[model samples]
Target: MNETVLYEKAGAVARVTMNRPRVHNAQSRVLLEGLDEAFAEAMADHDVRAVVLFGAGPHWSSGHDIGTPEELADRDARPYRPGADGHHQRSWDWNVENTMRWRDLPKPTLAAVHGMCIYGGWMIASAMDLIVAADNAQFLPFLFQYQSTPWDIGARRAKDIMWEQGLLTAEDAHRLGFVSQVCTPADLDEVAMAKAHRIAALNPLLAQMIKRQVNDAQDAMGFRTAIAAGHSAYMIANLGHAFFDAENPFGSRKKMPGIDEARERAERTK
Candidate 1:
């Protein structure tokens, strides 16, 4: 934890906080690398029986850092996976592979969600073992990498919240089994720590067995496959931006409303 992430330890619970409050904790490469190191630290510590993820801002996150000046610089300098294609390779590493790795982490992990949890926020929170959300929190998704919404909240509920750029309140998410508990904003931290304390009290091996037992069942039901396929579908859409006919091959949503004509057409769709 450096400038972007804050790592704190209390007894057996490790709190990993996203610290980019100015931009609603937008995930820049600096933040992601710091977050990875924090998680790794928690994973290696024998005394840390439970981990909690928090955001330090008005919202948990506004989603991926969509081309901020600092983020663009970091993206250019970040190394790509050696054998893998470099196009968005870093994105795949942090949001997909790392997310899944956190999902399978041996110890109990919890997300204390408050404010707006957008697309990229979902990538982090949904990877946790449990979630404690503030009543006012918003759960929004626009199909970012490693989309596990369908697995987290059943196929039907996933479609309801995601089919049309929709969102769910924390209460609705709790009802749908996505959030473990919903608390007042003032009590969110205390509630999350209380649960983490309970988890830490349990025998570590017992805790891990329970985690793996449930995840193995989920995996058996094709959770991993569905997640990979969801990202594949997302990329297809990301680069599938076009005007009328299929013209632009490498165009992305970043280039959407590309030309004057395309901007006019986009307005019409609105």
Candidate 2:
């Protein structure tokens, strides 16, 4: 497993922490692989009845470390020898795979979110069965315009967070249905641990059966299709020279198109 993910189990509860404070816990290829391995271990562990997913340091995660569109363009402009493996494709593939594995885990899982839960971080929480958010935590889904894809699971969840109603406050999320519960930063750990313990006390056989029933129902109804539609509809970022560069063309604090605008343009183009 990659060093970016830390896995430990206590009795029937498993804890998975994203351990990259340097990048604000950004989701890199290494972290993605580690998460995959950890999730697999959790699935195979019969003794574990629940999982607690959280991040180390102050924040949860930012998102992919793509630097900026300018960086992509710079790389595209230069003549470079192709690697044996398709790194770009693998990045996307690994993210989707590991994220889905967590989402589809048979046992219950909770995301203990604090600090800056933005972009990919938001998606990770949305994928879990339950979310326990701290009052100081801010969930931001500001990546709808940077890629051209549709109907992805992450995109669907992002839409609800960014639009549907609006960016959710901890209270709003509880009211709007994304958040399972909200607590203060000081009490977040206690609340999350208590919830996981409650879940762990449930009959593991019945809990897993119920979990699978819910996921299987979604799959039967073509959940991935809807996700793809959402992704395609909202992610209208074209792979152009502006977006492909070697360095971040847009500086750190730059603002690009938001979800509504990107969705509109994508729909119009279609």
Candidate 3:
């Protein structure tokens, strides 16, 4: 347990919390490291049969912070260094690794989402077996807000959620099977905890086998190829000249026709 994340176990359940409320639970390198530690501990704890992930305050998570301009400049100025192990995983590895672990956890996992679930946060939630969203909880991939791209899995999932399918509502997500259940903010934890208890009651060995099988099936689907391509494309598009053009070209990339008055006028029964 660290200041950035809270980890605790009760009976058969392990609970992990994103503790940075002021930033809407947005992750930095330190928060990501905390998540890794929390997941590792829960995985090794014999008493844990299920994991529940939630944030401490209003938001589920807002995704990775871009940092201040000064901080970004400092990062660009720093030299890359190899670790004693002869390989240094980048800072983003913490987020990527933990989300993968959640998706592959031998025991069942649940996400209790409140306020915002944007970008990287949505990726983490998508990795879980079950999602319980509050009525007001928003799943904003926020692809529209960033100048830079998300991590690999995040981009793929966001595309599927926001682009390939038009699941713009919490009800739409429920209908499309993105979220397993919906409830009010006050009742979200109750629903998630109840689901976790039911899952925990199942045979842990059987649960583990089923989880591994799911991952095996995904591996057969060229999941790795899709993830790599999506990540590379996102980064290249964001880092290229278009991202910094005077007109802010990416702002017009949103295809939600009904959202803009100009687009609505263009489609006026003509």
Number of the top candidate by TM-score?
1
* lDDT values for all models: 0.81, 0.67, 0.64
Order the candidate numbers by lDDT, best to worst. Answer: 1, 2, 3
lDDT of 3 at 2: 69
Scanning candidate 2 in windows of ten residues, the lowest lDDT window is 144-153
Candidate 1 lands at a TM-score of 0.87
- Any idea how many clashes model 1 has? 0
**Where is model 1 more than 4 Å wrong at Cα?**
79-84, 242-270
Once fitted onto the true fold, the runs of candidate 3 whose alpha carbons sit more than 4 angstroms away are: 68-95, 142-167, 242-270
CA lDDT of 240 in candidate 3? 45
lDDT: worst 10-residue window of model 3: 254-263
Question: Who wins the lDDT comparison?
Answer: 1
Candidate 2 similarity to native, TM-score: 0.74
lDDT score for candidate 2 against the true structure: 0.67
Candidate 2 C-alpha RMSD relative to the actual structure: 7.2
- What is the clash count of model 2? 25
- Candidate 2: regions farther than 4 A off: 68-88, 143-167, 231-238, 245-270
Estimate TM-scores for all models. 0.87, 0.74, 0.75
Model 2, 1-270: lDDT tens digits are 878899999778899999988777877656777887887898899888899998998877766555444335644674234541333334336555466667788889999988766666766777788889998776556433222112222456655545542344577556656678899998998899899999899999888898889788877877666555444433233132334332542222233333344345335533
